[model samples]
Target: MIRLPIKFLGLLLFFLLNVGSVSAQYKQTVLNKTQLLLNKENTIPLGRLDALKIAVVTPDAQKYGVFVQQLGRYADISSFGFSKYDEQTKYFNTIIVAGTEGDLSQEMLYMLRQSLINRKNIILCRFQEVGKNIPQWAPLLGGRITELAYPDFSDLAQQNMAMSIFGGLAITEGKAINRTEQIRLQYTRGEGSGLNIAKMTQKIDFIANEAVREKAAPGMVIMAVKNGQVIFEKAYGSHTYEQTVSTKITDIFDLASVSKIMGTTPVIMQLQEKGIIDLDSTMGHYLWQAKESNKANITLRSVLLHEAGFTPYIPFYRYLKPGDVQSKASTSHQTKMADNAYLVNHYYRDVMWPEMLKSAVKPIGNYVYSDISMYVMKEVAEHETATPMDEYVQQILYRPIGMKTAGYNPRTHFDKDRIIPTEHDTSFRKVLLEGYVHDQGAAMAGGVAGHAGLFSTANDLAIYGQLLLNRGEYGGMRYFKSETVDMFTSKQSKTSRRGLGFDRADPDPKKEYPSRLSNSTVFGHTGYTGTCIWIDPKHQLTFIFLSNRVHPQVSVKLYDLNVRSRVLDAIYETINEVK
Candidate 1:
């Protein structure tokens, strides 16, 4: 075993003795009472737990290293060394971080707040002598944290004593799982601040207007928020062709690609947080089966970000058996392609696996948005979580957030007659697609593949939309975390307009998106079936629009863009601005 350098240990002891007393709040508990040893200045107090050896990171090391050294003892902290000091990855749960007053880096303080997203246990301590101008760590922390600006070391000790008592109380009586009482105590008793909801709303309105003008549909919903509360919420257009069927505050809509934003992405995040999987793990690692050498190194991150370089769309529903085909079939041979039941069934079973045997193109070259990426993700998620995708989402998100209306093939949860139909696929099954998956590939896979299967209304989508706003926390429960949301939503290097499957700002105006949005903070997605959800976190707003654009003909891209634009403009106009 490697030993810690003795000189470093000596320096640490010197600092402990010279740095004056740590707080008496950390009592000198007796370990047989024989270990009591007061420092020369009678300033330091020691305890058995304190005696527990800790690896000291020198001041010369990176700042996060220092912060980790100081804070790690109070909680579990782990780190992966990066090539550069600034790029270090430190794992933190919600452990409050306190530091020498005014002495901490603002960025480091922000990191402390962000650590709370996946990890719920966090604490912040303050140094007696640091000054003001502390970094705004609230957003990362998910709320304003209690600041302990003690007048002296003695006061610091007393304050910690009081905090410890409160912390103990919080642990023992944690006002039921759904109760906000404990949080109220944390706010009132602890010096805490909340997220700026007003600002969140404003940003959303701006983005919604952009998406509305860019990708017009019949109806829309826009919302924005931070820390699990509504920043802004509004709806545009009718829910159905019948004008009387207005969209309710809670009406559910098919999320479409937004479903990935809700389903696969979040599930992957949770798996990472639970230590069950690594983001960088090769697809082969989780699936335990390699598709091909070219695809071997493709990670979950690559697939989620659409960097796996697969084809964009595949016409899977084109398969049919003889007379089962619609006369719309361009050729008798094309009709024959659909009628062979063996070919169609075999295609479903084999599409996702044996990646190496298919096309010779490597997975590393460029970004391509393939529905199959989600399909592969579905397999990885199920294998890792040991549960079906629907059940996994239900257990981890839907049930907790009260998204009772969200699911794949939502025939049981939604009213069949009221649900909007997407297409009349004469090519495959020759049936109207409603109350089931619109994507033929996902339908062939039991309507539960990673892509294009989930059915939710705008209202149900809003719950998830709001959950994203909160950075994975919603209602009274912690879902994922703010940091994970940031990672997934922030633009990746390969695409400016795409963060995983979510939308983002781009310089190219002609690129896909509602044309009105011209900023980076806005993120959203549109469905091939004329459904969309856009959110502006900067403004705390979200706009969801759902339409049966395929009613007469499956105009995959046909819609009156003006109607969506008008609604988007109206929502923006109604935005409430609060200083």
Candidate 2:
């Protein structure tokens, strides 16, 4: 017998291993139109108009042919990098992929996320068929592989998994539907064919309860709202360690930077609605420059989006007490003043801040978040309303919306003992920031600047969220038209994931998932004092987490806790589909 060469046998073994790996990988492919399964067994009965329009990616052409025949008029095959447009160049509602694995790369997932950001829906079918070891940056898919052990289910399992993992929103038969447990089971029902909703519910319950048990945040109230209703509302920790000041669902907070959302932006919207202020109107149109520069051309939106180019931050307190000599604590980044100093040692009241705004050298291309923009906007808002910014907001926006606790300059409507303190001033203005505004620049502007210094409670803030969802109208009071509201909340710049003053989550959740509801329509803002508010119009969801992390001292590290995101993810998963 002729013996085969040892090297040839070794080569054959290597090829077999590679083939097996590829075959496993091949389970996830770009399905063609012919392979989509749309028969009565897999797809719900639908009229011609109701049939889903789907884009499938798979490597098996023959299987695709069979799938297309099985699922009549439901699926279309597309190349790997297909444009997200209909035959008429309009947007397509859904893209059906064979699974999360196979030909899809991190870049492709990124592109898919971009399409979703532009409001396109995505359907990842047979997702578990995709092997494990997926990249982290692929939002839904990455979370799926890491969180779920790639379970395969009958049609019911797939549908239920779609709902839970996607924040109770799922792609079914090519349509994006909100939370409803009464999902019509289109697949064969038997043991192992459907997701154990009971198990998923238990896991969700643990996380929500953990959010309350951990009690990591003090003086905080975190909640998630869907369709203007509270889905998950809980208070973790307390308002004060002493327990004298406690946090309540309706307890007021010093919204700090969040006031930008409640105080100034609403007034801007009203002005826009009244044709009083145009987004493109230049800052030079409002405030007279103390000095000269190209910043006069910056628009109102640029300031809100932090593109007006002032500076990240400055020690406005230094100008408050200039004559007093002081050394700040090393931990303070030398950002504060001596405890003994007063307003005499500073020049910020009228000079340093105004000079920086006037001397903003760059011409508005670089990203720099500045309080000066809000101050300037406040000046313009006052000029436009022929009233103070606070009064204008109260009369036209806050009062009408029933936001009793929201304000910039709180002349009288607050209790100091019940309020949270922000910082101990040691650089220039040597005083503990308490009931008054904590932002130095806003303090210099007399505690009523547009960018910061608004006090509020969660309930009042929820009303603000509801207003945006209502398209700027609430309780018959019209704050802005739906178009104007959309313009304010929609993405404004490439770099700034921000609309007028709203901050959106990174399109790819893995880079940083801001909230559980990943829908691109969601928008909100964060306060320097550990506060966040997010609104998702798609599911009508809202999440508000308020904490005084800045208490005792200011540290920016609390943002990575994963407590807020994890708790929110659990609450979203808790949503049930109505039959």
Best-fitting candidate, measured by lDDT? 2
Candidate 2, residues 247-331, lDDT tens digits: the string is 6665656677787777888888778778988878887777666215567777877887888877666665454333333334343
- Residue 379 in candidate 2, Cα distance off native in Å: 2.1
Q: State the displacement of the C-alpha of residue 221, model 2, in Å, after optimal TM-score superposition.
A: 0.9
Per-residue lDDT for 55-101 in model 1, tens only?
Answer: 22112235434445323312223433322322233332223343444
lDDT of 2: 0.54
- Give the TM-scores of the predictions, in the order they appear: 0.56, 0.58
What is the clash count of model 2?
32
